[model samples]
Target chain A: MGKPKKLLNNPVDVVTELIDGLTAACGGDLRRLDGRNAVVRTEIADGKVALLIGGGSGHEPMFPGFVGPNLADGAPCGEVFAAPTPDLILDTLSAVDRGRGVLMVYGNYAGDNMNFDIAAELAEEVGIVTRTVRVWDDVAAAPLDRITDRRGIAGDFFVIKVAGGAAAELSDLDEVYRVAVKARDNTRSMGVALAAGSIPETGERTFELPEDEIEIGMGAHGEPGIARRKITDADAIAEEMTDRILADLPFSAGDEVALLVNNLGATTCMEMLIVARKVHHVLKARGIAVHRTDVGSFLTCQEMAGLSITLMKLDGELKRYLDMPARSFAYSRA
Target chain B: MGKPKKLLNNPVDVVTELIDGLTAACGGDLRRLDGRNAVVRTEIADGKVALLIGGGSGHEPMFPGFVGPNLADGAPCGEVFAAPTPDLILDTLSAVDRGRGVLMVYGNYAGDNMNFDIAAELAEEVGIVTRTVRVWDDVAAAPLDRITDRRGIAGDFFVIKVAGGAAAELSDLDEVYRVAVKARDNTRSMGVALAAGSIPETGERTFELPEDEIEIGMGAHGEPGIARRKITDADAIAEEMTDRILADLPFSAGDEVALLVNNLGATTCMEMLIVARKVHHVLKARGIAVHRTDVGSFLTCQEMAGLSITLMKLDGELKRYLDMPARSFAYSRA
Candidate 1:
């Protein structure tokens, strides 16, 4: 691939420029932190337990697109596929933190973990209470005994969504943290990659695979997966992936789940729907009830071609939070 | 290029299977018409002026995804990039029509115009009153004098949104048709394509371009556009596209409009945001106010890499209908 065609000015400014665009899109409801690559709600409620979500920038709607009513109060965006720096995170945390406290939720990644930890310590020094909930829901990354070693993927949407609601309604920082942790524990996701996305700065393909092969359980950034095999039918792929997720969660026959078929990047909505169809069938056959299904581009990896299936087992509390009204740049619920 | 590495079982069944998946994803709120390639709301109110929208497939989330509360009451889907047959359209029309009659909204294309017109006549013979409002919002396709010759692009979203709200609230089909016609008249759109998406049945690209070249004002199905040039910065592109759109409608300094930066298919959200940022700047500089902004994949051409900007000048009546809450598989509002 010769310099994947893109509409950009300077690759180095991708994060800042995109944040500027996102803030503009929000119609004055969001504002950027002064001299920092971060955004916060212009109307954050006083004394409300604030929800703070951040990660790399390449995943467009994830870190920033999700900042709006009933969602993250602020997001500190990082360089493409890189974690936000400690100072940037600290500024955003302080900006969104009300007198009540702040709850930080992000994917389970080493750089993000370190940076957020540092930011939390800095906030504590300044006399602001903060709590952290790292989401690790990708089952393919590690076995159940070592869940923390696994990476967080699209499951971050569920954790953030539940945490956002809890922060808005619960008022207590510890209660919000508990809700976020519960969401992370109940959510599971797996991804498959058919093609790789190009990096914004270099225009270089993230990874390469044989023309006819696909990597099952691939990471969003083209990390190695469990197996690489020739591409197969949508039904077969959905069956196998669904079975793996169901068995891993040990989701019982009567459990209810909110199903998500996330377009990793470039996969068409048609393919995602087909995969969702098969996954629903698999779930039905195994006696699992789908309380709701969301299929779209919640989290993406540039223009990489593939998708991930996420199932968040829902209880009355999780369901109430997930079903609550939300309005954001990337997601909304009636 | 080679076979496109799609996750499909049978290429010929792409439309049916996707419809199945969409209905399943709707959680029983939508159902497929018996033995027809169409879907309708399961709980349409009696004696309501029904809204029916349909068009070719390939644009996943467009026809079917828009079927739900406060949106299209039904949609008849066609094969990939092909218009639905008259029989399919008529069946869907009859299914959605209440005693108050039905209103049809769709893109302005030769095939769609012919099929929907025929379906309207067929419905008339059965005492089911029907009216049609074709969206011709692509300014790049034709000059102002020949507005009807233009192709409908992402502007269809605005038209359908207004019409869906009107049909649900207004008991008279003629009143609903008037609102839809106003929406179609006020909306304008233009698109640019960086890469072509493949057809599901045959891994064939809809169109081809040199690696570094981009096509501006291209239609959804690889239709010829007005300009082909080397890729440039997002600001320049956004400025040019927004200027052309503003000139077409002569959107005045004091006018307020709803803006949409729609991803045709594979373009990343980051790029769309950057484009949106520039468009907002241009609109502000010209003194035109944006009432609301939506950025996402509303209408797409499979996995084509490009986006379109749509502007719909809003009046009090238009704004009322546009702001109505809607719920669908692809779109939702709080």
Candidate 2:
């Protein structure tokens, strides 16, 4: 295979250089705390709860882009698709703690869970308040009994949006964490990947699947998919992905939802909208009301050649918070 | 060549369907005029100057996205990569014609210019005041004396922003047109293409070059690039593109500029930012003061592997307006 063209001082220098560039782009609203691999917001409201979220580095604007006035205050940048160290997590907690407490939100993954668990233990020794809310929205990542054990995907949009709104309102750590968990519980997502991705450092394919085929339930990390099938029409692919997610989540007639049609990096906007229309058709046929809809690349997987459908079953409170104004590098609502 | 995926229903079906979707998405602020292809903001300020803009449809969040509170009052949607008809332009002018008159802003394309000129003539005959400003920002599209002869690329971003800010303050048509013209005069852009794009409808490639080569000074419509050379690092690409654009414009050492690093399409955020770093280095080496910077996938060529750099020579007033709060589908500042 031909090598991917990239520009860097050294193979190992990609992540650190990108982090510094991100800080500059954010115009001081974000900062990397010295002596640690953690990023913190410049403005921290005293007496108001704080939120710190993060994941692997390649998912730009995900955990990092979600940081701002009404969103996350810190995001510990991890290795490419790898979790951050426990010390880094503790450093982020220390930086964001305003005596009101902090909530740690991220996708459910083995490495992240263990590291964050250790960080929480460390915070407890200092009497710093800490809470963790695991987002498990990828219906294809696990079966029903293991739903709580599934990995997260673009549904983290809803999770961060709700959690940020709660944190901005001076809600305590427990309250913020509760709402975030509820948001994650009410959301379901499934993705299909049409192409494989290459890691910048190693120049190696993250995962291997035959060309001219697709994985219906590919995770962000190039994880093994749930099913394999021939590449097909856009509508067919949409139907398959949406069908499985709706069936898994059990949205009833008259149910209301907020749909997020997410692009996994390389998928075009034209493709994302096709996914959105299919989602609309599916929900409308079930007499489900789509309270609000965002059709864009809110979360991404670095040009993964696919899209994901995230449906957050909405309640009155969730809808209100969902409608709240937000601004980020990749998305904004005023 | 393999068959290209059908990203939308059909090429002919896309513009109308997208407009319909946008109407639903705009939530009461937008309405399509009766019996015409025009969209006007319902809350258009009475007795305030009206601003109108339009072009090909593929660049969503462009002409249409800029229509709102502090921007153009209306925009006419056209076929993908094709200009709207004279009738559409005339209808848009008529719908937005308040007592204060209207200004027409569009990229400098042959079909768009002729059609808009005809619309202006027709509107003038009907006793409605109208002024037109053609944006010509692509330095590589044509020579300096024939700048107006070149096509507009991403530099239209600065044009719309300044014009919109002027119109929002209820500036007269003449002032809005003047500021818009000034913005166009001061802006210059040049692009580089790594891969060719398809029209979606035809399922045919727009242009083709060898895999190991790149086309510098590329146009947005996949027109022939100024130079085709062997692909190299991002730094080398930036050097050639920046040198050509800066030489054509000839800026002074201490000049202040607002830079826009736009992804044509398909270029990942990581790649785009890499280009951005080089752009900054080039401008700084010339002792220029960079006022504000915007780097994102603003203008696109439907997954084409390319990027464009737009340098807007700015004064204090222009800088303030450019930095003012802007809320659009794809761009936002608060």
* Chain B TM-score, candidates in order: 0.99, 0.95
> Which ten-residue region of model 2 chain A has the weakest summed lDDT?
A1-10
Model 1: which docking level applies?
A: high
In model 1, which runs have C-alpha deviations exceeding 4 angstroms?
Answer: B1-3
State the weakest 10-residue window (summed lDDT) of model 1 chain A: A1-10
TM-score of each: 0.99, 0.92
| Model 2 lDDT, residue A40, Cα | 86
Which sections of candidate 2 miss by over 4 Å? A1-11, A35-37, A204-214, A230-233, B1-6, B32-39
lDDT: worst 10-residue window of model 1 chain B: B1-10
Q: Report the C-alpha lDDT of model 2 over A1-334, residue by residue, as the tens digit.
A: 2334443345465556566555656656777789455668888878879888987777766767677777788888788778888888888888888998889899999999999899989999998888898899999988989887899899988998888888887457787877888898899998888765567677676776666678988998788779998777666787778788788878789888888877776665555655566667777787888877776666666656677888898888777677777765555667
The numbered model that scores best in lDDT is 1
Q: Please give the distance, in angstroms, between residue B212's alpha carbon in candidate 2 and its true position after superposition.
A: 2.4
Q: Candidate 1 lDDT, tens digit per residue, B177-236?
A: 999999999999999999998889889998998988999999999898999999989899
Global lDDT of model 2:
0.77
